[model samples]
Target: MKLHAGSNILLNLLVAVAVSLVVNFSYLLLLLVDQKNDPAPPPPPEEVLRKAERLQCGALHVSPDGHGYLLYSGGDSIYVPMQRIRRLGLRDGDSLVAEVSVTHVPLAHPVMGKVLRRNGAEFDYGSLFKRPAESVVLTLQLIYYVLISFILLSILTPVRFRYSRRRFIVRCVWCLVAAAGLYFVALVTEWRTGRLVFNFMTPRMLDYVLLLKCSFAVVVSMLYGWVYVLIMQQQAVAMENEQLKNEYLTTRYNMLVGQINPHFFFNSLNSLSMLVREKHHDKALTYIDQLSYTFRYIIQNGQNTLIPLGEELDFIQAYGYLFKIRYADKLFFDVDVPEEFRTWLLPALSLQPLVGNAVKHNAITTVRPLHIAIRVRDGYLEVANPKAPKLETEPSTGIGLENLRSRVHLITGREIVVVDTDTEFIVRVPLQNPAL
Candidate 1:
């Protein structure tokens, strides 16, 4: 099973306690052997024993009635019972206070002189609970753990910043080499002074290798967990950005395709009504055909990001026919696109919106003629029309122009510009770079 932060900390603490206990036990055993023949030293000083803080170090073993724990400090053992508190009343990792007192005895007897001579009496468990040093010990352990974590994260996480498969393998080898160096250092110190450091291994290469392997396993597991979490965060951010872009593109496409104004449709129908009343049946049929072609091109281009300039101009010509039918002799529409410019790619529906904006905002009548012009000039496409006053009942919303500007900006690094020259309303759009 995988170890969580709490479980890992608990395991580390247990291992430390076990190692300390073994070292203390071995020291006592050696003392007993020395005193087996020689007379025993006096018991540890009363002042030193009394001054020793009683540190309760063990897991809280809860009981049915309330709570209780097996408390051990030095050679003393006792039980602490809390019969009044309920399960919900306590929290995990909580500690209690305790004070302890004991009397030690020395032995001249063989093995007992070194080992058993240091034995002490078991003090009252209640007195110890009243002032236990568990909190201090736990606090110190917490600081130790935080410091170790900070050091490891600072060093290894940065290493991962420079990490790759090759680097990881190299680092693993370096850790083994450093562990070998440390093992040799420990062995030399022990051989001279006859004391072990951390009891990592016996005096052999095989034992040192096993100890290094275990430590490296623990460190690498931690590194992998951290790295996995960072990778997941980065992937999530990238996915979210992709989703946002797709949504924006979909919305813009739908807006451009579906947004032919109702005003334009109604006005064209009115003009068709006038044409029929005048008995121009042939012209009426031609106007209907042009209208159909205009709407068809719009629908077809909805699914495409870009279309040939030639195709767009053909659609614009059909749309101009509908305008001619509406304005009769009062409006003139002209196109001057060069043959070389015909193959240039432009965003679909780019021209229609600009023409539609002019039709919607300006007035046209037999008495007041409106001349609209389109041409490709000097690396730009210019659409210009005479500025006529708005008819009193004309729809005044300028959303079509605004939508065109935004779409142009998205498709190319250019914006459609409008210039009013006393009598003309001119819009200039730079030729979109095909490379873009």
Candidate 2:
């Protein structure tokens, strides 16, 4: 599963912290070994130590009242008299380490004991160079490792995996190269600073140690990145599948709508031919004009999946005019859709098929006139007609009803409700709000 953005960030931070702790812990262990192997020399004379203590060899801080100094040790603070101190060049919060006398006598002065060994924050470049205190070294190491881990995670985590063997191999090689390059840079920095940053290994074994460390860091980073990439790829595949499904539905709807146009065209021409043969030239001309207007509406909206209810109703008026011209007073449509619901959208060409179906299956005469009602009620656009099915009529293919159902469901996500009884046949189409 894909992780939330905040979760991912937190996880990455945890990984960096873990890596930094491990690296710094290992370095501290190595530093202990180095100290054991290379011991410090013997202490200086008592007079010299006393003079050094008075000179403030360690970091010095003036008391808040400015009457005394506070010398900071690794885990302790030593109070010293301000008057006794001399040549003290230290500042507040500066890192320093000092060795003081382990005395048997109780002192009267604020000086804990005379300073024997002293080290400062300055970098020593001599042959027997002095190193910074353990606390400073460890803190720097932790900061360096945490920064490196964060950089590696940011660089690697967003890379998408390509499913090719050659690309995979290339990526592995690139990671190795990058790791080696970073290791080399670290080595150069440590050498320039004359600091033994990592394990105190012999020159012959140091290369292997650095390589192993770098390789482990790179591998962990790549593994984290690969897991993220897998989740992202899965989401991408799902999105593509959804898009293809929608496209298939669109194409299928267009095919259904395409079927309606040809069927409607043939029927309209038949009606037009009847009007021409009956010696009603003026009526036939008007029928042709109405037919053109209806066809124009269909052609303009044929590719659309949904259109406003008012627009479809206007198209229906033009279509119904052609049929009225043919049947005279025998066919009629009663539309009572409210003005408020006119802006609601519905599947294109939805109503015309139902009207055509009713006319196709019913018998229209002056005595038993056909009445189709189009109205809105309870969030539905209902097209209902009085049942007058003929006994001798062309066989019903049932494509029109099926097409209407599929198109309505695909576009509006609602089914067209059909009700058939002895007296009436009704289709309740669910209305849709395009703005919503």
Top of the candidates by TM-score: 2
Which 10-residue window of candidate 1 scores lowest in summed lDDT?
A: 109-118
Error of 2 at 426 (Å): 0.5
Instruction: Report clashes for each candidate as comma-separated counts.
Output: 10, 0
Q: Work out how many backbone clashes candidate 1 has.
A: 10
Distance from true location, Cα of 91 in model 1, Å: 77
TM-score of 2: 0.69
Residues 290-365, model 1: lDDT tens digits: 8778767766775676788889888888887787777668777778888988888777777877887787778887
Cα-based lDDT for every prediction: 0.57, 0.72
Query: Positional deviation of 155 in candidate 2, in angstroms?
Result: 6.3
Candidate 2 lDDT tens digits, 1-436: 4556677667777887787777567778887788789866554434444665533344656666544444553644566545433324334554333434344568633453433334533323332334456666677757766666666765555344454445545665666676655665553124443555444333433466556656667777778767656666787788789899988987998899889989999999999889878889999888888898988988899889788999999999999998898788999999999998999998888889999999899999999999999999898999999988787987999999999998888887889899999999999999987678
| Candidate 1 off by > 4 Å | 1-206, 261-264, 365-368, 390-395
Query: In angstroms, how far off is 360's CA in candidate 2?
Result: 0.8
